[model samples]
Target: MKVRHYILLVLVLFTGTLFAADIRFTASVSKTEVGTGEPFEITFSVNANIERFGAPAFNGFQVVSGPNQSSSMTSINGNTSMSMSLSYDLVGVKEGEYTIGPATIVAGGKTYHSNAVKIKVVKGRAVQQNTQSPSAGGNAPAVSSAPSADLSKSLFIKAVASKTNVYQGEQITVSYKLYTSVNLVDNALDKLPDFNGFWSQEIKNNSQRVDWTIENYKGVSYHVATLKQIILFPERSGNLVLDPLSMTFLVRRAVASNDIFDQMFGGGSYQDEKYKASSAPVTIHVKPLPENGKPADFQGAVGTFAIQTAVDKSSLKANEALNYTVKVTGAGNLKLLNAPKMNFPEGMEKYDPKVTDNILESEKGVTGSREYKFLLIPRKEGNYTIAPMKFSYFNPATQRYMSLSSEPYTIKVAKGDPGTNVTAFSGANEQEANLLKKDIAGIKTGAPDLYKDEEAFYGSVGYWLLILIGPLAFIGARLFRKQQAENNKDQVKLKWKNANKIAAKHLAIAGKQLQAGDKKAFYEAVYKGLYGYLSDKLNISAADLNQQNIAEQLQLRQVDAVLISRLTDTLNLCEMARYAPVTGISEQEVFDKARSIINDIETHA
Candidate 1:
């Protein structure tokens, strides 16, 4: 009886060990490759129950649906088996190879890991046969019994250009349109073409909602909407290719749900299917301007343009400045066209031109006028004729060279004092004037007594002190002036050096406002403080500052991506708070965050 019991106990121990060793945790994906807009499922499965679960960081993808959990237990004969799975639906935001890291789960006071998975996101949706079912995996819900609709036939994007062949610097408009025959829940742009050899500007769409209209394409009626309009000007002469534009649309289609609970609770019997569409690449032939009639002084101005000139006053006294305005009006490349060269008479000093552009960018291309104001100052008394200034450009429409000239003006100047010139007498005159006011004694001709000279030179401490301090003072002054000169020359470096102090001053004022319970004033102060700090630190203009530009500038400085992302987030938060009403956020919290961001930037930058 004892021997039989020992044998039975040993067999029972062996069986327990075998069952324990069968515990396994693994991860899998519905598909290894997916479209940028399409959603895919990731499942973490184990044969045992977990106490805690930790997910991996999905860096390049956005989470669409969440931690759906399912478990099952089965008994076959005398053996029992159990399984649990956690699944997530995710959508790729960009096209690249991404790695989903291992997920951790705790079971029986021990941690278990799921294997990592790699996924490839292509530019467009995967091609599917008409007979194949659209439902990918068991985790996906089925909404109908019918097969999935044809995505390529139901949805598409078309890129159309106004002109394919154009001269360099001529304007071309490209329109991106979307046509669909199915119901679309939402759509988002995945990729915007980088016009490498062209200057491109987006024409803003005022209406936020997409206005769909019925249109016919290839004898098929479909709903169409204009997605975007871009105005591009080729910068070089060559066969330039415009890259393809890509977008993703979330489509709702009929599918049969196998789960009775899902079918009962869910209002509709449809599943969301993501479809991607890309426009065809376009080729443009940019031709160089004809050199036969190209003017030597051509300002690279293309398209039809006209020049108008006026002077604030045709006649002015000597040393007085006169405003001479040159306005160029019409369409095409107004921002890029160089200012017309002006030739003023001798004795008339001309400062740099102050250029102002009133160009309105639209589908018709850049239109409006750019005015160049030349401030001319007469230095001496004279009667001089200001010769006519000429501007030359090639008009692609006319297929010929065009020139516009400003009318000549005669100026009369009266005499002015010579001393009015700021550069006339600088350091030399000041030094001579100081020296002339002092009286000078006659030079000593006879030699002094040797003992007296020794007592004054060697025995006196004051003489040695003067000798030691004189050169040191001169050297210090010289170094100080040199440093001042350098600081004046490098304005960017100077601003960067003082950026922290300036930011601190602004923050201090913000703190005061926060203490006084002025919400609006506090937010405004914080916004200005942060903006000023970025402007000074990055040496960028306040008017031209933006999130995209800021990130680019930080990248150029070799700042880490995480730090740059934090800076961007902080700026965006401050901007939103400035315009919107303050709700749950505290002013002190914002102030602290701004301060922290500045400190981090200073440490890293």
Candidate 2:
């Protein structure tokens, strides 16, 4: 009887487990019919442990709040079940029928998709604001019943610029603020200014919630919040129009009623309505930099700037790599400026510069340093003077062209190994050239061992070993020849196969340098390792390799975006550490991160 009872208990638990473990992925919506410019909710849920999720494209909707995550777990008889969901609050921007595409999620090594949903939006009736509310001039709130034409004065968007008139390539700060005298339930961006003919950078707001403060605008109290701040630089001289910023807001207003049931059950009724607000178009008069005052070396740089040129090694072997960095520090259109043109005296191989930006964008404007790192390799031994690089920019504040010159760099190149030609090897760095020199066979020295032809010839162990070696060497040579032939067929494949191995070699050297407390050598090895790996994996020549190129190639290969960003950051960090003392990160950590980046690329590539 006890055995039968145990069997029954097992059966019951098994049934429950089967029921709880049933998995499903589905999409659900709050409502099918939504008024145009009104907001709604759509949620995608999966009854499994999710590894990653991809959101569907809402073609006609603007995302107000999105991808809010929630998870749940339940345990029955020690058998656990899991479920997770991602929801987005979206607003329809157009009056049309639209289909929300299927969303994808990865679970248990397989991808699952949720069903698509369709929604229809139609023109909505305008919301009415029941007159004026001058807070502190306190007026009781009234319910909105019908469309009111005076709603624009209650809630509006304003675009304020620091200066309406500015010179081309000069910096301008523009702030978009929201002025609302009435309450708002929900809001989403409808349209943002394109800022055409200008290079623009936004001041990023990190907070999730909008902090509103009470302010008096035009002698009326309203809640104000800055929505977006942008720093602009006119790319060309002319009249440029800044497009208006627009938003759709769900407004909550009180509705009065005289019905007996309403009076007995509640004091009043409230209604939620849809409303739209837009800022007025703004125009800026951009004047060209005065031709008479402009310096010949001006590279379209506008603002106050200082330039400094630094070379890591004044004297290095011909095959060794040299770091020539140009740092431009100041406020202005740094992003618009091009690389300073400089002539590298003949015999030097200059690769594309690795640009590093440490700029900060805020309401104050964009300011920081931009570093251009050039990896210069000298092929022939000689004395080279890279003329003092002259950087000039039009200073709007001073109304004059300012010129700054970096100390001229003197490079003396010594002869390297005759066998080591840096131009022939794209990935060769300083350490690599040394390794290449070591790889060349040299003459044997102090050889004294000799054996006479005697009894040691036949039937001896040495004789048998020598006799066997002929066949062994022949086999080894044949295998090597076959592999080399295959490698010669596709150079890309060859590089791909050897990329990780080469990266590992550089990392080994970096590790040694880290232990030896050599910051310069350590960072150089790390930088080379990362670049070498990318050169091999992406089939990009070392000469044309840069962060942008690496990102484009990796993205073409369908590699993960986050991994590409991580690799780029590692390269930047190594470059920065070579110049300045890196804080908050140890050499060991940097080494590990470089290795991990290589490993991750190998895994994903």
Predictions in order: lDDT = 0.74, 0.76
Q: Across residues 1-605, which tens digit of lDDT does each residue of candidate 1 receive?
A: 57679999999999898766666989999899988657788989998755568999988876654565544333222123456778887777788999999999866547888899999998964322211111221112322222355778767888899999999989999988877777666666678776756766666543223466778899977777777787888866878887888987677876667888878887446778877889999999999888898886785788888988888886666777688889999988776665566668887866656667687868787799988887777778889888888988788888899988879988887877665543222223343355445636679887753544555477478788978898999999999999899778989998999999999998998898789886656766777788788889998875446566678888888888988877776675564443233444677888898899899889878
Give the range where candidate 1 is weakest over 10 consecutive residues by summed lDDT.
Answer: 130-139
Clashes of 2: 2
lDDT of each residue in 445-561, candidate 2, tens digit only: 986667668865679889899999999999999999999897689989988999999999999988887888877668878987888888898998754566768999888878899
Off by over 4 Å in 1: 1-149, 255-268, 417-605
**Global local distance difference test of model 2:** 0.76
Model 2 TM-score? 0.49
Quick one: best lDDT, which candidate?
A: 2
